[model samples]
Target: MTIIRRSLGWCAGGLALALAATLGGTSITTAAPPEADPPAMEPTSATSTPGENYVALQFGVFMHYGLATYVKKRPWDYDPHEVSPLTFAPPAEMDTDQWMQAAASSGAKYVIFTAKHHDGFALWPSDYTDYDVASSSAPDRDIVQEVVDSAREFGLKPVLYYSWLDFYKDGGSDDEGNYHFVASPEYVQFAKNQITELLTEYGDIAGLWLDTAPGKFDSGRLQEIKDHIAAVSPTTAFVPNTHLTEKRGGTRLAPADVLVHEAELEGDLPCDATRPHEQSFLAVQPNSAGWGWWSFASRDTTVTTAQDVMVELMRANSIGGAAAVNASPGPDGKLGLGNVNLLAEVGALRTSPTAYVTIDDMVPPCGGTLTYSGQQTDSDWIHTRGTPTGGGKWFFGTRTHSNTVGATATLTFSGPDITVLFEANPGHGIAEISVDGGPPVAVNTYSATRRQSQPLFERHNLGPGPHTLTVEVTGRKDDASANTFVSLEGFRINASANPTIVPVANVE
Candidate 1:
């Protein structure tokens, strides 16, 4: 927000006003810029393997630190002069290691730092520009390096957010200078230079989170950047921050390993991680508005509690992805009270492995259509669908529905030590179960209260490879159906069920 000053007392007299003309122009108006056409999205390649897991580093934090924190500004809001190489300095109390420890304390798996923002200030000592943390006074050190080092100490993967367009530095005060670099070969060279530094200096980096690349740098130039990264850090991943939808539409992204969806769930200070895409997110939930320092005393957002973070994090686990939340710090390099409190509460689940289960390689063979009524009442069923991992009980999907006073579907199977995980969704009512179509043994569908991500584990003993099996979803009392996403990720078969249970292992 630009600060404005007004003069009301009055323009004294003509002569007095003439003398005061240097002070103000009554109503001077600047010429409006031409209406440029809307963003013409350059065609981007879509994922060929759609509907598959595209998430790896799903749950992490986007650290919006640096000068922006010092001035209660957003990453792109601060001026380089405010904390430039000439004027920048760290507080004597600053200890980045402790901050990373605190975040690790909250159970995050990785950290994505804003190494460079739209504001154009470099967090590390960049030869690309002089306006950076190195310009700070006293301890003229590279802030980005410190944070990355700290992340390493905490065992959290470090990803870099390198903004291709700068609002400051190179653009200086040209306003549109940062974005108008479409044809400027200089800007392309500038970007490659910085990327070269990032890849070479930061060894063993997890990935690069590229954002806001100007139109000037086309696919060829972008590919150059990709090659540069690979040549410098072969093991590191390349993840552009298009943050596009999960569905195949509108530039879904080409060679990206991770997808970003930095969005708010409930009570959140909204930010735009959203783009022109269809699927809500490929992975990585958007951080709250409280992500950075705000210059207001207004109630920021309180809806997202620690439990909320946990629920989101667990959901990421279900989808085989991760979550990156935004926790904008105050100007003084400290987490706001709100974030600190929330993380502390979620600390309970930080290291609790039982809280999550990973499901992959589904091999459902006898699976088919599911329905409610008619002569073929959804009464009987047996299905298997999955890709094979090592060997184990895969997550089960209850694709059947009921429409009667009471409807039920049951399955009987003969397999050795195969575990089936049932997660009752919203429509799934209280249910009773039976194993191997044996005597009716009751098990709650467990879809109420503590039902956010309801789950249960069942194991059965069968033979070597193919085994007959069945499952029954019996509706009781009142009829209801949960048309919810039956989370079926984490699949664990007994270690003993290894080679014997792996039916697909020998598939050609």
Candidate 2:
């Protein structure tokens, strides 16, 4: 995930542009696509793998801290000269235990702390860089150590989010004036040294999360990173925020144990067999619109409701990925009352009257046939046990580049509510869908990332009767899309004689 940061002490100029890039969903600039092997595939039911545990952490907490916490502004917006170590200070009442306790109460299995953000401010004392907690006013305090210790105490796995870009180091600025360099061997080695320190010093880190793909490294450098981390922490899972799907350079990514989806989870995209997928998003507070600092005064407005948190978790679970919700601590180093209460509510749901809604594959009526078009063959309608890796059993259409626009699949079933679960990939095209001869709705099935069994279309309250759902390939993609191909996974029908609307408030 792109870090929205600015210098605490510098004038905002290029930093604003950088902040815009992160906010607008764009990377600063990445190196050319690296030549590497495709990500390895893991069975949906694989166990004892390093990533298996990480994947099981369905609900986790993400906290972004560092200079931005004190600056109370976008830390990525400031230049090197704009930042000063003198301005750094540890919270007067530092309570790492409080954070962990809150996480435990919220039923979170893991906690991922921002060990270093884009501002290049290290939460831990690093011998390789003076711009760290050790060189600042809080020289004696190691925020990373405190967090690690507290996580262990609370029985929560501890993970670290490390930024690849550093503005305060020798590579002061890239061509865009961002803190990162276009290509700097000095910074690369610096990263290795700091990572070694973190792996060697920190005891048993569950995962190492790298922010923004290394816009600089090809497979060689990426492989080097994996080797180094494996040497110290062989079991540690490596997850890169590849963002929106394609690898850093638009090619294959250097192999990692897991793949990360920053925010969006499209239905057509399936999880790669080589790596499991994770979904991380902004856990909204009352008034805060984005993922960042929230002052005590802003607490009232930035608070998030417990209902919203539950929905996010449920959605990720439905799609076979973990959800890491972002939450920031106040300057005092403690979570707000509103966040604590929300988490408590979520924890309560664990043992309450929860209805496990089972999603079943739609079986065509005995006489009805699912017609297909294009160069589609009988073999194209392949049955997959768990698509999008870990998704429910379903069938999908598969074929080569036939460019057979207008190819379609039509299904008629007796149901009041229906949902189409489709695959969205970079090459997917637009799909025209209609219900019972209703007006056609064009559903763009294009996605940068791969996800399977994504709930693409749904219609409820159709009244007791049979309906026909027809899906046709438009054989077209938006200018930004990579291809004009389309995929049809399957459908989910809710044909219950009576449907109950259970209010969360009524759940015991």
Candidate 3:
């Protein structure tokens, strides 16, 4: 949930995608196969890691709940009444499992619930403080415990968002010194006491998100806290997201087990899948009209928008990092039921069970494509396109081969001169093509709208041999993946042209 990401960015809603939610009604649909793991997220035609520990998950729920939800005021509002955790607010009867099952059906693979929000209200009983759920009128119920149990029953990864500074707890802050003892013993013990209970009581936490550590990094407290978690469970990821005001990012003072960057990625700050994807992850919640917990002020939150989720999905999948969309549950312990239901209806992904391609083999002489070889698993395959949601072709998420940076691909040429027909720009700027090592030749250099074209016999003469070809893509230079600005359905070889099928070598 709070695992760190590598960039600081602001994104816009250039294109809109809808999110429709479906109530998890009737009875729980007995579990089916795990929502097939999502197709592997691939970097822009490049490298691969052999033993990766993370999954490229597209859907997750972020709940900014706990006692803080009811008290809309800043989490720091200290109400020493030490409100009973459950009494924090009486929400409509909780269908905790109902929501969990809804998430499962709505394609969500994980849930990041707030265990202790920035306010430091523990959702479960903690031996550390009286300011917890146990003190709440609902003291009898362990909401966090129930949420985790329900999440597991449906196979959702339950990542906990824990805060580092407990404005209310003794010694929970970085800058405070006096009143409590510039260095009070209680303050020191409180942090440990709470963190210990979180790790020990929660079963196999998927990850821990640490927020507001202030200058704690320099003091080596970040690592100390991480060590505490490891002592309880070494397999989990200890992600510390410093509200760092620096330019580089919001990673831990030191290289943490994982890095996290929050809401800022507008420069050359690589928030996507090429180059080196930091083990970094990001939490981006796009603003509708403003930055608040209420439905992005009427418009969907960044996570609810298609374009929003798509950008994050691309950035994380390509770079091999986790992408978490920030979603805050309303004071009612719900993601604004209406909003959650909306998110469930819209889907852009073409689940693997139904994806296929059947186009020509003759590329526009711009580049040669390496056809799919094996049945790629969810994380290993996806469809890409040059447009937001238009003509894009399916390709291997892990497919990569070398053909020189500036070079185009083609096979030998021969057989007949029959004109090869395929999709390409015929009415737009110079439609170009290149094969094997030949220079890129223009097909029709003029046109109006974007249109597919039949090959030009004038420049394309064949003598029965094999040749590779590629088309120069059109769009922002930022676009790089094969799906960049083009829908790569297979290509068509001039039926009369000679052809050879060769298996590209060393592409594992």
Candidate 4:
């Protein structure tokens, strides 16, 4: 996300109220009749474009935690050259798990973590530069690794944000003390080395968010880096910050997998039918005194409520776009209480009866039961329990998976609609999903990239009664897949006709 020094008044009140009126305390409304036939399931391909995969993640959190958090300076006035590595003192109580919990509570499917900002301070210990977390006060902590582990444990995809302009290495004032941007050949090689380390060292990165590369890197250089990234991690998306580039009088670079619109309200930017697009904005607006993305000491109250976030989310979904709300952690590496509560409230709103209700594998409603059959002793269904404290209320923190052929897991529940959620990765296989003993639809849950809590099958307008949704392992996989494993996260159901919807005005 870019840091633009502009003030825009928050005017989400009317939109929030309208959204609530449309959804609150109303029976589930569909464009067609309640008895409309469910659509056919489309098969997934292993070679699907990265843009499609990225767009599947409808929401994510943008974390700006780094040296800028300690300085507490506005974006235009901050100078990274004056900040010392010693100032980067994160307490031992700094828990990435807590951060993931908050993100899970926000109903985000992915997390875009700032791996390296404009200050050239890397969260991971890169051999190319000494100005990183390894040289800071927390020398032993690998912040990137911690974030990746925590994000996976909470069933959220991890994406990295890297800045191209480095004040410590290739940026700063000239001999006359005038600000300048430089992209030296040696610096470019150093960046390439660091990027290789990031893509290779990490297990599976969803994408690489390249910031501040508009006027600095030319097409040739960008192409070189893009080709290199493809060689190492083929599935990782190469995304340039188009929002900042276009705003700062730079052309949008080619070969970009996704387009970014910074600080734009929902529906303001047109949806890109050819590629995926995303909008990133601050979760809490700055007060009268300006503050950067990582600075929040001046604001004690939350300006962006859960209703505002929900409206933005629903609008983005309507336009086939994704929303990444920026939330800053304080100098102590802890999220503000207001931000946590705001996220949790949004999660609760999404799972309300009027909204799509998420039912975890172990915790189902309407007397639902999950039964397994055709299990072998050597290769049987394995139930993995999630950490009780890691995932918030939205996540059940439990999953079931198996690689055995002919193994089936069925969910019997009383609901009008249901959607099956699963995990997709290189090791996953094809499965047959059928509703009420209907014709089975084959779904290939194989992807070069890894994503969790993905919707594999969905059905609506089943009336209201006891129904069965079954998934059977087919012992099949794409050519690029490693194995034939199938995993289940949970299911989402619309159970009741009477909906108790909370008004967005009340939340405000």
User: Would you list the clashing residue pairs of candidate 4?
Assistant: none
TM per prediction: 0.56, 0.59, 0.55, 0.59
Residue-level lDDT tens digits of model 4 in 137-179:
7778888999999999998888899877676665332333222
Better of 1 and 3 by TM-score: 1
Q: In candidate 2, what are the lDDT values of residues 1-508, reduced to their tens digit? A: 1122221333344342122124366543323122231233333333466576686676788876677777766667665456666466766687888888888887888898989877788888766555677656677888899999999999889999887776666553475755234547666667766776676688878788877534544556666667666665766778777553353336546566667766643322232323455667665665543344323322533345555555555444433346677666776777766666666766765433131222233223221235555222423333333234434322322211223566566665543567776667767778889998999888877778765545689898875344677777677787767887666655545423111111111111
1-508 per-residue lDDT for model 3 (tens digits): 1101111111123432222223464331222122222222222222422112323343455555666555545465544234334447545476677657656654556677777865566787665555566556465678788888988998887877777666556566545421122324565456655656665677866667666445434436566666666655555566666536234353436535545555443221233222212222222245432234322222333444433333343334333344555445554455544445434532323132112222122121211223322221222223333222244322211111121222222222322222333233322233345655567655432223333322342334544243434543232122222322222232233331111111121122
> Top model by lDDT, which number?
4
Better of 1 and 4 by lDDT: 4
Candidate 1 residue lDDT tens string, 1-508: 1111111111223321111123365543223222221222222234422112223333566666655555445655554443433333556666777667766767766777778876676777665554555444543577778888989998888878787766654432245544435535555556666766776687656777777453343556556666656655555555665432222234434455455444432212112222111111111112433332231211333445554554455334322345665554444555555555555555654444234222233222121111222223333322234422333323221123332333443222222344434544444444444444446554445354223223354555533223323333444433344432222222222213111111111011
Error of 4 at 272 (Å): 2.6
What TM value does model 4 have? 0.59
Better of 1 and 4 by TM-score: 4
Clash count per candidate: 53, 34, 67, 0
**Candidate 1 residue spans exceeding 4 A from truth:** 1-57, 78-87, 171-183, 214-218, 244-249, 264-303, 350-471, 474-508
Candidate 4 lDDT (Cα, 0 to 1)? 0.64
